[model samples]
Target: MGDTDGAEKLLEEAFYNQPFNKDIVTLVFSFYMDTADYRKLIKVAQRCMAFHLADRLCWHRLGTAHFYIGEYQSAVLAFRRSLEIEHNPKASFGLSQPLLALGLYEEGFNRFEERFVANPSINWIRAEKMHMPKWQGEPLAGKSILIWSEQGLGDSIQFSRLLAVLSAQGALVDLILHPHHSDLEGVLSTVAGINSIILIAGNRFKLQRRYDYHCPMMSLMGILKLTPAIEVANEAYISTPASHKNKWFEYQERPEKKIGIVWSTALSDAFLKEHPMHAAAKVKKSIALRQLEPLFHLSHCCFFPLQIAISEEDRQYLSKYDNICDVSEKLSTFSDTAAMIDEMDLVISIDTSVAHLAGAMGKETINLLGYVSDWRWQQNREDTPWYASMSLYQQTFEGNWEQPVNKLVRLLQ
Candidate 1:
């Protein structure tokens, strides 16, 4: 039997007995990274760096740990140290995130291409194999361009605003989306400039129509020379169908104010294990149902759970509150979710697709973020450039939701 507990115990004993053993230290560090124990990874990485200060691998690991904990400056320094030892593509790519988060767009976007080089399996990398010419910031007056989706659903929703800008420039835009986003086909089709929405599934991608030029959706930032000034000024572009909008109103009794809540994320343990870098943010972004009990105490405010899938524990927790309604079963599609959000007075959620959907819908949203949030949220800000109606409430420190939750309670009161 493959016993993880037994293996962990044996590793601990080996580390204790041979504290200075490089093999043991490396193994322990790998274990922590695999398990998503970032706190322990930081401690172990620091110890490894102390013993092997000049080792590029140690510096890279230390940088990664610092990056996870929101220590951007420290991470930058550590990655720089690793680069000094050797020109590492992964370290160079790792350096781009914090720089981008700090609003160093030019430098960050310049180095952002390293992501495709580092992660060979990324969608953009596959898109590169199509042998199509990438569309730069050139005149597209008579050109047909393919804008393929990359990363998560939230990313696609956030960047979809740029499609309108491209369309206004007289370019025929073809959008290639993931199959999971099929629900958005009807909603996105309504966008002025989109010529087609092709969903990638099985071997269906090979049969897609051609375009004059192609670009990844994220590349639009660099291509259009997006700055905070331009981004913040952008308004909500997503629209809801009349049928879907009416369905939401018909399904529910009108409350004084409908507040939507998403306490957790959809990122599975398997996905986190594969992409350890996102693990820390994922952990910090999700809050337990009990932690949000403070908000539930507010009177005259009806809370609706916007999550598509609810764990049994959360289901039981939700059942205890009359004011908190579970509408997960009814939310079969992203359009349905958008419709419910359109009906909401406010959307209070942790970092999730719901937040993006609500923000894109121009809903008054209070987005609760972790101490170290994704690059899009930026740092030390109460409002985001991505959504004008959305207000951000970030954690003052790691693993402390009390402060943000208290701030939210006061806002609600």
Candidate 2:
């Protein structure tokens, strides 16, 4: 039978007839899971347990099926049972996430530390250990601390705040920053405690020994216990003589609120794969353009794409909008992006590097979020704790932007 309901009915009859048959039970249970009939799957799985046919795989399924259906507590119980029978690596990973989601932090962090062992990324497996540097707070007279950037450009910029704080704390900080962000190094080096800057990919640092204490950039957020309540400078922190060229002083001279728009999605494929807190469940050019259309219409906004040349459908959508301006083809470096963003009063962007730029500059930012967002943002809140000036506007439902965009338009007005 081609109909899923028909297949399900037939499986139910067969399961009733031969309830203890492992092969038949597995097939029917798999079908139930695939069809997303979680309640039925649970019943079938329980029957397997009653028949003493419970296996590691079945228990894993039982736990994850509950997890998928939002029965997190029950999912935890099932996952524990799965672990009791046999150590299932995937189940450990699965158990870790829901526990974290439920705010079981101490336990969750312990489990998160096992990510490399339970299930590791390819990079983790192949990644060469760079002799984990130490951050020794001793000897204010001579020791250097290396601040290593991690994850994405946004992360680097967001955590760069720590550099200033640590520098002020009287440590001689040396930054290991992304080459793209080296334009920021000069300003960053001038921070109260920083002694030098080294671009990780470009410059060679001659040192007597490795850094005293090495910190991945993200950990600074937790270390500082930074929340939205922290006060920040309301002006730009980085500037360059190069960015000053062709800089529209006249635009600054005017009274109009100049806003920058960044519509191009970054890491589109990576996000689509994980679907963690998925904002855009899938990438459809028409939908992406529609999500962005409202920003272009704002009178105070100057819409800019840091990049062009997505799908043809997206290109056509851009063609239809007269206000969309992309000088990204000419802007290859963060310095150029910084120069343009410097001229703007605010930035309205998707979750991209432009958001990072705006946040780092202490510009007012409104981040357009997809329905399912990243894990870092957590659930529904209008503001992020990481950036003081940044506010979030999220899609209420998946693959729908009208309501959110309408909300943004009203906010813009």
Candidate 3:
């Protein structure tokens, strides 16, 4: 059915004949990585490593395979072995995830920064080529700094705590965004002590205020040796505008538990085009609206849609269920979304920005995690240090939402 009919067979034959050959094994590894067949990769890698114990690339791929499949300890072992062979950026980057998942943030945060060198397509690296002076441990008082968001909207919102601490130190901090991220300005602009918010799309008008320092928002954690905390320094840093909160005041008839639901991730098309595998991963994380019919049947819990850019199929699915209100249309900005979250008695979301937003606001939230969630969620724990108001529900089985959904239903009951 596809153009590469004979390729898989030829590669399989080559790999079978020359199992310990680095070049052949690498080609096979790339084939599996492209296909996202991690289990098969593990088998092949383990066999390769049995003979070629010193192969760092083989150990790295083995560790990555274990990481993808939720075996954090095994991954840690493999990654450590790879690092022992050679202190490469790819091994360091691969090692960081499992360590963070295991709640060892200090080392994880330090090593995670190597991802830029391991995979250079990161947007932050592109920003650095323009010669933005990074802030080390310099004095913040009476200094002006520009902190820009690195990865996704969720990450920007989650790590905005650093901005608050900088402001508290009287650094005269300002938040900067990419040109396309102007919509986020509405949410971040309201955070206390931000001097100004600028969107740098080669706009000379916005760049009029010269900054003394420029740093990626996520980098502050490593640079400052900070860990994720909710109560002490990082308590509810995101501020919802009173006006925006007032707009959602009309929906506050909470006789039953008012629950807001987010089933899909809202990623930019540009980002999706750049990372096709992540676009595919979106399907793994998203739950079909129809599949959540059981949750809708719960009469005591009123559900509201927290997702923007609703797909036609999801829209049709929403139409079939009267309980799932289509309030997503009213959420023009993240501030509106934040205010809407304030109205909810409980928020249930798959790991997305809405979940992070709810957590940032200190709203009671249930985060539905995949079998192996992002390192931020950590592992084997219901509670996260990043969000005291949030509780995690992890999938016991891979590629299945039934377990987490059932848990939510039980929690609602």
Instruction: Encode model 3's per-residue lDDT on 1-413: one tens digit a residue.
Output: 46444777788899888876778888988878766678989988877757764488888998988988789999999999999988999899889999988878788888888877888866532555445577876888999998877777888888877787788777998887765556778778767778888776543333566677888787788777777753336457676876686678777875767899998887767887777667656866777776678798898878999988788888887887666778889988888888898889889999998898898888899988888788888778898888888999888887788888887778777
Relative to the true structure, how large is the alpha-carbon lDDT of every model?
A: 0.80, 0.63, 0.80
Worst 10 residues of 3 by lDDT: 200-209
Q: Which stretches of candidate 3 lie over 4 Å from their true place?
A: 1-10, 20-22, 123-132, 202-206, 229-234, 254-256, 267-276
CA RMSD of all predictions: 2.9, 6.3, 2.8
Candidate 1 residue pairs in backbone clash: none
Residue 97 local lDDT, model 1: 84
| TM-score for each predicted model, relative to the true structure | 0.90, 0.67, 0.90
lDDT score of residue 218 within candidate 1: 79
User: Which candidate, 1 or 2, has the higher lDDT?
Assistant: 1
Winner by lDDT between candidate 3 and candidate 2: 3
What value of lDDT does candidate 3 attain over all alpha carbons?
0.80
- Order the candidates by lDDT, highest first: 3, 1, 2
